[model samples]
Target chain A: MSHADPVLEIRNVAKQYGQITALTGVNIQMFAGEIVALLGDNGAGKSTLMNIMCGALPPSSGEVLVRGEPITSLHHAQEMGIGMVYQDLALAHHLTVAENMFLGRELRSSGLAGTLGWLDSARMDRKATEEIAHLGISTLRDVRMPVRLLSGGQRQVAAIARALMWSKAALLLDEPTAALGPKQVALVLETIKTIAAKGMAVCLIAHDIPSVLAIADRLIILRRGRIVRTLPAAGQTVTSVVSMMVGENDDAAAA
Target chain B: MDRFRHPLLGGNTLWVLGLDVLLVIIFQLASANGAFLNPINVQAILTTYSQVMMLVIAQTMLLGAAQIDLSQGATAVLASVVAGTVLVSMSAGGDPGPHITLPVLFLVTIVVGLLAGVINGVLVGWLRINSLVATLGTLGIYLGTAQVITNGENLYGVPLSIQSAFGSVYLWRVPLSTLLAAVVVAVVWIQFRRGSFGTHTIAIGSSEKAAIRNGIDTRWHMVKLYSVAGALCGIAGAFDLARFTTTDIGGHGNDALAAISGAVIGGTSLFGGKVYFFGALLGALLALILQSGLVILRFPPFYQVIAIGFILILAVAIDSFRNRNEMR
Candidate 1:
């Protein structure tokens, strides 16, 4: 496939734990304004690939280029505008929504108070409100509400909002709908489309085939640490995707 | 309604305050002619526990960050011993022989405390030692060092002015040390409520992996927190020297227990990620009142220990119940 420029490019990425190889010779490229669904079973290397891309785990041998520049270290990846939303939704539940949105990168007050580590809560609240609105999330009424009080869908939105807030190049989401109800899943899926529509690269890792086929522009399938197929989402049915995922003939699996 | 439930000044502080008021009333009725309400007795209670209040503030921050320091009281004693020994030796060497002033002595004691805190911080924060075991081991070392320094005797001859200033001097009938403790509490309360440091600390306590992913230097922050705890202990040591005019080596036996219990009672969870400064202050006051009130009512002193032990268990049980509710 040809694109103007790729936002994230992984070339021949591999991961090994001593004698066991978790991933081998994986190649993938994510472009701007596209939703690429990473599909795989339990032992698949989807997590390993995502980890390497986000700098959480180093690849045994590979080159990861962000916006055409090589990057090392997770902090550098963040500085290069790559962000991830973990499956567990890494949020401090006791802190307010605004606080969680700006967890480590808090806005300090201007001048002396700021230098002394005072957070500018008003500005944070206002900014958080604007971002939530930008994402079309209306369920979260109060920016100052602690995250623990939020519903599952709202928490997922907040987590996605956090990743999108800092990620200028690409956003990686791992199992955005694993524990979510059907309604929440729809909300998250819609949010992901909105994020991609804003001209940012979105990589979604999920198992549910119908939902993945519903929102994904492209589908990348993984099996036994290898990319088995990369196909266009258009004109594809769940049966074909499942057959590809489980490496079985479509007619046999259906029978 | 939202304002009432505001996280900072809301449910926890109110509960602790209500408990404090109830205790005061009970003590008033239990004492002959309401002796527990006597101004002198009240002031004594506030002043006597002021040191523990200071220590509790430090413990609150430590416990909120999912760590504990059992060596705080021992560190205080070590700081006082180091400062007092230097002063005594300098004075014993006769006129103009490196005499140490109170300010210098105070500075020395604080430095000693900071050093001790750094050691604990490095062990727990950098070395990744289990906080309880590390601090417990340090507690023995610190206490042993203090004893060895003074040969099991008190280091006396603290300047009379220092004693009067920290002990007798009262601002509007409140001891200076108590006022100082209030200031420390206010400062800590503000940091816990409004500062990024406090937010980062709670975040670390909540999930270290999440905090790291969010770009927080968890180990560095942990080290800094332990160092701050040590510095506070040192300040408390200075106050101890000034109040009693001596560094009584073994006088701090119950301090760590009282401080930890008070912090726990104030809603600083052992599981971490939550702290209540005002609640902790009230918890310290409650312990002090219970002890002195029992004395006034002629109950055996051992009852104070029993009460404190019971309160610790009760606090933990309540915390676990609250956590369960949160999970649901």
Candidate 2:
């Protein structure tokens, strides 16, 4: 890695809810300019691992570090440059796309107006427009259009763009392509690739094997609350990945 | 669909405003002998409209965040009672300390309102009680508290001159209360259009979970919203004493419903995240016009209450229809 330090690192992280161990002994690193895909079946700890990494849920043990500095809370995680697009997008559908992008971190006008909490709407709209353009996303035309009006893929792009604006080290996408059409899926993959080329570490948690194979540079597969494999994705196929993910094929071969 | 813009407020304000004007014109034309347009009737409507406008302003913000406060009227009644009782004891009832009485009375009234609001906020925001139920419970408690304070009798001995000064005075042929209401509306509208609190308020109402995930302290913010509503009710209570110079302990029972009717009739959404302050003003005005015009046309006064119920239902129906069709 160019920086010699991973953008994000989770070391010996484990999570438990009562007697249910959601994740155990999870260790992962994401270097800048890298795309890491987290794959697993339902209840396999993919979501738990991602939640801990994003600092949305605390791990029972271990630490989440951004640029080697431990993150304390979700707010701290964000402050230290960990951004995430939730599975549901967590967008305020009644607000415009630009407003959602800058929600809770709005840019206010200078001087007294700012102190009084008056927003610089022009500046925010301009900033959002500039960010969208800088990301090279052409699907969304209006920043002022409420998120409720955007297509699913466009909402995904907007959420990604929002995360990108505040994130300096890593972007964690939870099922970014879930429920999108094939063409939209391709668009999202291309967008992820574009973001990775910009040197942002991307951790993609997705269920679609082929889509994961096509976009992810590395695969980390988990089963029954523990990671089973960490393999490079340069020459992996959908069938091979699927067998490893389900874990039954390995048992059959052993038998 | 394309018309929605502005970061803080949006939606069809002009459409609602237009309807308000049409309602006024129809009233002006239909009332027997144009009585609705007569200066005295007009004056009476403007005064009562201004009086309830305080609660309307409060209810607008509450409903804009998808919250409801059924105790605004009760809160006002209690505030007025406490403040009036204190003023009478302090001033010995003659003009009630002319210079200091009104200000102090108003302050005490508002603080009580604010305290009542904080209780509601704590229940809803901290304890996670449903807002409607919380406020409804507080309504009973607050009204009961006022009744207990006065032994179910309206408190007398308030200075009559308060009515002459703050309640009935006219600066430019309009009721002094009307002018004061205008100032309040103007100040609040500007803030709603440009302030962070206003933006965040809508954000929370639009989707509380989304707002919380985005780093907004939805729970804490809810406390502030309810507090503001309560404080406004305090001011309305002060107005109650100012206008009538007596505690209307039993009179303002319908204030909450009237205010909600006005706010919803305006463009503010009952589901939260949408607010148009001017639209709310117009909505309240429409209700006033409907009630007053019916009176002039010699319709039974009970029919006015029925009209209000019908109009409130119609407004919600329209809002629901628009919401269902707009969202995919």
Q: Give the least accurate 10-residue stretch of model 1 chain B, judged by summed lDDT.
A: B92-101
- All candidates: TM-score of chain A: 0.95, 0.96
DockQ scores of the candidates = 0.52, 0.61
**Poorest 10 consecutive residues by lDDT, candidate 2 chain A:** A1-10
lDDT of each: 0.83, 0.85
How well is each residue in A1-255 modelled by candidate 1, as lDDT tens digits?
356789999999999999988999988889999999999888888988898998878889988889888779788888898989999889887677888899999998999988778889999999989998998878787988877778898899999998888878899999998888999999989999999998889998998888898999999999899999999999899888888888886447578
Badly placed stretches (over 4 Å) of model 1 are A1-3, A250-255, B1-8, B93-100
TM-score (second chain) of model 1:
0.92
**DockQ score for model 1:** 0.52
Error of 1 at B122 (Å): 1.1
Candidate with top TM-score is 2
Q: Over the stretch B138-202, how does candidate 2's per-residue lDDT look in tens digits?
A: 99999999999899999888876667667777877788878877887777767766877777887
